[model samples]
Target: MALRTGPAHAENDPATPSQRQIYSQSIAEHYDYRFGANQPFLPSLATTDTGEFINSKAFPTAKYCGHCHQEAHAEWRQSAHANSFRTPWYTRNVNLLMAEKGIEYARHCEGCHNPTALVSGAMTKGSTINRKFDEDGVTCSVCHAIQKVDTRGTGSYVLAQPAVLVDEHDQPIYGEVSDKEILTHLDRHSKAVMKDFYRTSEYCSACHKAALPRQLNDYKWQRAIFLYDEWQLSSFAKQSPLPFYTKDSVSTCQTCHMAREPLGAIPDYGAKDGKLASHRWLGANTIMAKFYNYDVQMEKTVAFLKNNVFNVDIFGLEKNGSRMIAPLGTEPVSIAPGDILTASIVIQNKGIAHSHVPEQRDMYESWVEFEVTDSTGRVLTHSGTIEPNGDLDPRAHSFTNRLVNIKGEINDLHQVWNNRVVAYNNTISSGRSQIVRYQFKVPTDARGPITVTAKVNYRRFDQHFMDFAMGKDHYPMPVVDMSSRTRTFSLGENPATPPDPQDNPLWMRWNNYGIAMLDAQQYSESVHAFEQVARLRPDYPDAFTNIAIANFSWQRYDDSRTSLTRALKLSPHNARALYYLALVERNQGNLDAAIADLREVIAQFPRSRDAHRELGFSFYQQRKYNEARAEYETLQTIDPDDLAAHYILSIVYRRLGMADKASHEAAMFADQKDDPTASTYALDFLRKHPEVASESVVWHTHSDLEAAPSHGSNAPAQ
Candidate 1:
């Protein structure tokens, strides 16, 4: 449930006080309020002790912050966050949203990018927006003012009232007065900067994870950004009982971005031995730094992108009879002319906490550029070429997620509200790798020493998004070469037969390729890749389990059952295998078998959420309302914010004639039903003005409601 700090009001009321007044009151009343659960909610604005909402003007500028924090301020001034709201690219989109859906709807975008404008009441309809302080995007005061944070991502934070010293006349002191005055009121500065929340990933998640309100998307639930959740599930920040957990090596948001550095101007209170965290907040966004002409920052960003966080290698080559693929080695390979060679470019996400291109993947572009040439500089074959019109080659392999609207058309624009289907998602997750294979005939008269080069390139925004955002005034987005590998092959006689797969050291390479295929939702291709492993090592239980998973995803129930049977026969107590087998049994209408398998899974892995949920569902199917209620109650205890559990419990309680319990569960369901940020009022305006969708070149993808079931919690990981 979204906690409001302001006075209680009717749900349907529209003419309440201005957002500024509400925000001020909320902060004043709930200054000490802490989040009860990690549920997503909108953050309220910060306020002064007098119940006055803090605006951009209330905060000191970056220059003022530099007085005692020179190096940090200097680094921040060159960061993308400093110029976030003032950037031409950003303003263009914000203005477009404002014009199409009114200023009220645009608040969703401003909530993160231009919080100053949002909190100051400048974004209200017909209000005069003050751009004076817009340049100070995400300033020092805005971040330091946060008091409490909800575990939920997407700006679920509460701001504390600023601790300001008053003059003799009772007026607030605004800026730097004097060193002597600062020394006299040192406690106020200490209170502002001493919050432990500053070092937490939850603080960063406030803006990093955003979702489209159900009203905006015209769907019950729609997630737009997932960086926070991705990080939570990663080895760096594992909170759940996942199979992959690295206890010895743990990292936080501050670890990589805020490395320790010597302070240029030591603060009187916070500095420890003249060392402080570097405030560069460096990310893979060199284009913006280059556009802003921050030469030093651009250099640093470019260096970070090319630092081998992601690696690209020519894994292997496939031909008529056999394929020779392995991680890149010093050995040179010999290929014959006129032979059809299929080269595999393996792109691995090695160090990123989430997917390679983490957030706003629809607009951002990450793809592989493969090129093969001869010693004479003659281009033999090339993929991922940039067209004359600034478009990428259609055949190029892209690591992006494509959304489909209700009409089953692609939504090229970044308006995620209309998304219904994740038609394709090829982004590589952390510790995963993708294999893109290209088949081309080696020319009969081809010269010796054919060089193959594969590069993984990243762009902040793709050509299609830029075309819509900037139209004819499009500026070329810089493409960073993330990682690359070059391999040269000399013409020679091929080995009669490729090395045996069992004897080869690259078995894991093939297994990783299969997992990549699974991640991409290419079930058939994944099965084929896993079959190679099954053939090599028939006794390998994991290979059969993988095959079963692919079959299960494809809805081939009999095939899945057969594969699972083989897997269970090999390793009877394999929890993962048992979990999927239970799912297959449930889908096949074998309730008893499903329940039995789920019980076994629970006994093996006590904290299996999926097993518990499935067991409860099976009991509900059998009309055992009391048993269903008990299982759902356990689920509620495990995940307090489990909406599905609450919903099911509501029904079960009602069925059992427990009116009070039913009402309680129903209320919890109602509170969390719709996201606070999803505006029904704004949606009504959008429905009346359907032309907005037509005018935008971004709405290219049409959605198919029944395309495929979403890869939700029940879905198995690759």
Candidate 2:
């Protein structure tokens, strides 16, 4: 029988059908649940506090939680948590996996997706025990039961089943506590679930950063999902000072998703000042919410997406005659008929603090939808328009990935098992930017003063996936306009937009554009863009550093040094300026000065991976093998996957008479390096498919723009 510690509330959900009691060891009965060679879940296949399989029934369900947290539970029940496994799309995917690879393979997803079924051993072969926890999905106590976690991810968490808090004798105090007992000793209930680590981003990393290991793919390691890893790579990680924006603090996962709200009708354990962290886990899951008729959740989800989380700015126009660049829609700029225009649009991932889109990029759709029309509303050029069949136009520039298998065929079924290569991925990193230069000719007969409107739009799922799952006749999902900008160009003069608090400052907008150009490796254009930023805000030290970074990449060693000198004058101890000064000195062969600057950078920012890398390289240049080895090793400790650290360590180890360490470093370097032949895979597919290629060329032009005239043709080490 089900454990009836609490008084039943009316009747339980029909989906959670009553069934034969599932004893701890009854599932599998012989051995723990397994997946090929990788036991994806907990080491013990879920465990008691004593390290044995605990009954899934022991974990309190949402209904039990609703006895006290009525409002919170009601909110959670309507969230993605309650429906994670019950959702039709997720159900289809898991069912497909079971049919194709068997239940054992489902363990990989269940570790985070459906832990109750995972820990209960229901994922094993022929385990017919119906589980209440299965319907609960990620229930109240599932998260509360977590005792420890490893931030390396892939559901690297340990759950203690005898309740989180223990008794005086270090024994489980929570296996069968009655509702009266729990209510009387409410302190135990709070301690049972609350831990300091629960507030950390690393705690969320346990499940957010998932990878496809060799055991599952029967091939080399592949990045499957890395939301946490992307966060680490962003400015939010606070490990580097090279980001375009100033980052003052580390970002925890709960910062945005769990924003606190005032207490409602139900009481909460952790409520302070009548406010508590929300359990709704607000995110981009409109597809699930809309399909289930969750109107509140759907509205909240849409509002969250539209809350200035992204920025789309139409910045400059590249004039056809004389190739002059003018700030688009500015009062000083003029537009005329018979003129060819290349308008520059900048997209900024302002709020996400991570990748614009994190996982399985091709599945969820986000793109820049643009249209150029005359004042009379006559369309000139339209891209990213919706088709009659609910699909986006083929020519749209999307924040997605084009991945293919060995045969160069695109996989649309969210099938990671079939993925082989990534042709192109267009996700903007946190506090970063991507530039789109859209070119079109103004027709001689066109009306004057045209309007150029561009919007960053989003959809929860691709039309292809929706159609496959629900058939073509189902209602189409909502298409949200995340961020947008509209500009008007007059025949004689274009007016600039009036200043608004919500809009980015003119200087910062130019700086953002320069940063994007720098990332795109358009050194000359980046230098020009940074020059405008410096002209606009010379007092800002970051502007000078931006100029220096562009110059350094352009191999203008003297110019880089000049910019860094100006930056240092504005702020004598700026780490970014100092770091670039060292790079300029090193490249100019001023070894002693470079070392001194690098040491200062290391002193200020100890975790600066780039500082460590450059310092190691400087030591190696001076034949200081021992010092180089130590710096490289420290760099390795900071980021184990750093290919530069591995490669240099390989050389430095042999120089220091450590042959085995040298060999290991060399192998690690090779293992972490990108596949050189990977580009050919994308190129081959694009060649065979002309439509995709025509659209892709513009999107992939980030790395191929003509370099502006600079110091040297050969690029310096970035």
Candidate 3:
């Protein structure tokens, strides 16, 4: 439905019907005269009847929850989810990415991943969230208060007033239907109507999805994180009812992750009267469980995921113990110095329950490390390495993706440098594939087998980072080797090679490219260059995709999709293509077609994220909020603090119209105004967005309208 529009001051104008505006204006007036809209009707902090934590105190802390829920607490402590704010890894990378970009770009990541620390007023110049509350990460308050989810993948969850139960004397009281523990604090917990929208997948879309750059490629929607979407296209999304899969029996995320535990009988360990869902909330981060020495918790999480979700297929071993194929892609092919050598790597998001690399975490670093050397082992070429002090070599290629930061009007920076998240996210989606191409001159004097090695290296924290943030001894903060692969090229007795002229076609068709361009050595220059080509061939699908891809590299998913969709329509089923029509359908919040496309992709290319992420998202939109959250949450296990997963989950809360959730997510994007790369996403979004008439406006006291309520003349007699 189209939104109504009128003068900003039309409070009682019968021409328009939305009462929200009038309500907002009234609330705004109350704000000016009193505490205003910001006043949260929290239960009195001084109240004493709320249940006591394991330790009784006036104001119990999160630590109190740990006593009764020892297992959950311990797991949380080791997981990034627990250390959202104080994780040394996030701290160091956040500082680095922001330093290189700007502060405005960094906050987008901080919103969900480190919300407690960010909102506690901890983040600022030369300061990080390393305190008590911040250390607790996303505490109970963060989730319990989530009343709504936006679901459009914009990360627009809404925060709501505390649900309180009142007493006969009109005193405030609060109760937990989920827990038996009572608190000392009390508040009015009237049953507020929670819209079923909270259950839908659209709720996740609000934040998980990102918009593309309008300046570079025109505003388009790119599918950045697609966990929910991925599941929608999977067998899990289908109902077998009376068929092979079973009638009305469809697999849901909650079915596996949040399954209720059966009650059992015991003396001291007697189970609750009803079934209780496991709150361990575990996923793929077993390493974290190991880090805090929380072996039991880690083992539980690992066992749960390995037993429930997909299996891992590790490869890349050489027959003669010499070299292996690339860890992620297909076998490597030989090429001359000037040849545009091609290598296809298939880094499956195997273990993750949903999409891989869900969201933007400053410390979430994943890349293919490539080293080319002669048989003697002397390094001839290397990429994805950090220098001694802290800086990445200007010449080396990097696998770590980046977001855009558009803080200033004229100047734009990558999200790492600036705090703004204008648009553009470059992370591999679940069940998705990204192909990398590197062209180098085969040396004229090259002889024998020229070996090339590629490792899917992942690190929790950058090496030089800890010392830069928390001081020196924080050295060697573990960098885990998630996976690796390799291949050898026969450079046999090659004659002197001549320099090959550069082909601008790859640069000309940026839209066809995805993650590859995100790490392009000439990202900034290529952005402008591709834009010109797009302008020259405005109707060309490839041209649009090229420009769109550039915007996607900068984290502008919204804009990227527009062009990609057009490309798909113009040329369907192009194997070497980026976005499939079905994938676009799922991203646009379409379910059925997304399923079809995903199935088709699997039939054609067995390993694909297009189907999985889209399927998951579609299922989420289908009022399966818990299921959706589970899928996205599962992705985070593989890639901790994945921005895409968190963002999507936040949006699910927003679409449900949950106020607290919306506030949390809005905070993430609120500071985007200061980022250059982020500007493109927000600006294009607002411009193309059907304008929402002002929700709060002042109305002049003109003449009073006749009151018609209880009067025979259709007007109330005054």
Candidate 4:
């Protein structure tokens, strides 16, 4: 059975102490948190708390690694992950952001860029470390410290404590993480189970997606985070049976970027036929990497990106510029009469890592441009192109996102400084293919041959949006065309045989294109795209439901209502659409209607925290304390670590005249223990704002750690 309560904190909850810590300390007598319970069997090392006797030298430093693994090391030296902290491009931008938002905000960027130095107590004002931590970019320790990975889209991880030891059973163990050979001298120490989540997509997401405190949402930092959520809403997730797409789909990040290589030494762990994961860690960002003189890594990254990309399949085109790749509104291949002629396109994720447009977790991009043409190469319908001002054509089917600035201005230039992406559509994950469909009436005067040309395009940033953000002249963004395909559809005596829905190219394009429109905030365009989706896949409730949301957001109230009705008629228990319907009704001033919809939403998705939270807020507005409290309490059970929920619960308790309950909830914040980096931030923030120290609970000193009686406890390092 699942545990009915929350995780026990060793120092915070005095009633119970960590058993793992106590047991290990008793066995070792002079137990050290850095080493395992049993010290490694090393002849040159002394143990216990006060004594250390390791004089033998072993292992190679990064310089020595360059001696043998020179090629690999050279590639790593220039990547953004390497110079993340000190690159001039980042330096100027970071400094600008710091001057505007203060030091605490800047830590968000530095956290990922220079994690080692940031963690090692560098990064103070007027600091003197340049290029020191930039040697390896993402060094060996950064990845190794990944103790746990959370699979949820929220992207949370547990970092491992740094400790290196040699074999304790075979030799005396000393605590120090210096060499790979030292691993053999260490005894395995297991604590809380380290699940596979650590190695999955969620692991990459922790730093990839970020959010701002509620107070800072106005600054638009929330848009900077949300890459993981983008993928979750993609067709990849819709069609994926497993957590990630399997072979029929393209391989994911683990399959390509971190592909296993032959292990020459440690075969049992990951060496299969002498193969283990290559540590090259290459991806996009070629220009920036090369700018920093890290061409080797950039070359590898460019090669990887160039080789692995989506594959396209085309059927045939019609002379009137409309192509009939398959029959619309049917699955598999069918010969139904009166079916609207459809063009089908099959897009397969062949080699890209994670998403097709990787690292676009923030900038909202990834699109395919299509131009149906005559034999003379005359233009037909075009979607996704750069306008004169260098922003994406608003009406085109393209990857979309909102652009906002610090001053609440909309920026269309999509430049760096002014570019604050409010949304995006780059959700295509590795190893997944989405079929798209486009329908056009066959003109009786159609010519014999038709050509459909498609191109996969990208832009570094939307310059127009950027201009709005920074209110200054900006540089043009670099554009890259990834892949393209063309095929001639020959007119036949009878309408072309309808291709299977699974193999439909039009649907494939539409599916991916719809994602782009949604990302770009072309709500009406997305709804129009979904209309085709609904027409093609009428049985799929999500197609209609999503369209309803698009319509609602665009303020087409009645149309949105009708679409929701149709969706419910198709799948009466679609909790998602029902919730959307409720939202629409609430926004339309039909409180009762919204309540009815919420009731249905609750019935279908009982454990939905979003539904509960929204409904609780609704009830609380009506002074329904009991109802609001019940919902909030339920939410706490569903997500106990949610400090926001606890804070809200405190308010509810106060409203109910439960002072003790409110005090307890408020105290949770008072006793908050800052993480290493966070403590440093608190110290600095308090120094600047002494008044905050008095008003808010602050924990940021050595005395704070010492006051915790359990500080010296010896817990197993996992």
Residue range with the least summed lDDT across 10 consecutive positions in model 1? 709-718
Error of 4 at 420 (Å): 8.4
Worst 10 residues of 2 by lDDT: 709-718
**What's the count of clashing pairs in each model shown?**
13, 0, 165, 67
1-718 per-residue lDDT for model 2 (tens digits): 2222433211231112222123443443554445433343532123334334455666667787777677788778878888878877787877776788777776777878887777666777766657666677888888888888765456677876636333444444544446666676566566667889999877787777776554455555566667765665567777676677866777768878888889977776557799888788888888887787888788888888888788787877866744545454333676788887777888988788678787656688888877788767677776666666677765577888877766777767777665667776777788888887677777788887788888888887778888777756434777888888997777666656565454578777787788788878888978898899889888988888888898888889889889999999999988889989998888888999999999998898787888899999999999999999888888866555567988999998898899999999898777657667666777777777765575454334221222122222111111
Please, what is the whole-model Cα lDDT of each candidate in the order they appear? 0.64, 0.72, 0.41, 0.48
TM-score of 2: 0.86
lDDT tens digits, residue span 169-224, model 1:
43334433444554565664554445787887777877777666543444555556
The root-mean-square deviation over C-alpha atoms between each candidate and the true structure, in angstroms, is 10.7, 7.6, 21.5, 16.9
- Candidate with more favorable, higher lDDT: 1 or 2: 2
Query: TM-scores of all models?
Result: 0.72, 0.86, 0.44, 0.53
List runs of model 3 lying over 4 Å from the truth. Answer: 1-68, 88-135, 140-356, 359-363, 390-401, 404-425, 440-450, 461-468, 471-475, 488-718
- Give the winner by lDDT: 2
| Winner on TM-score (2 vs 3) | 2
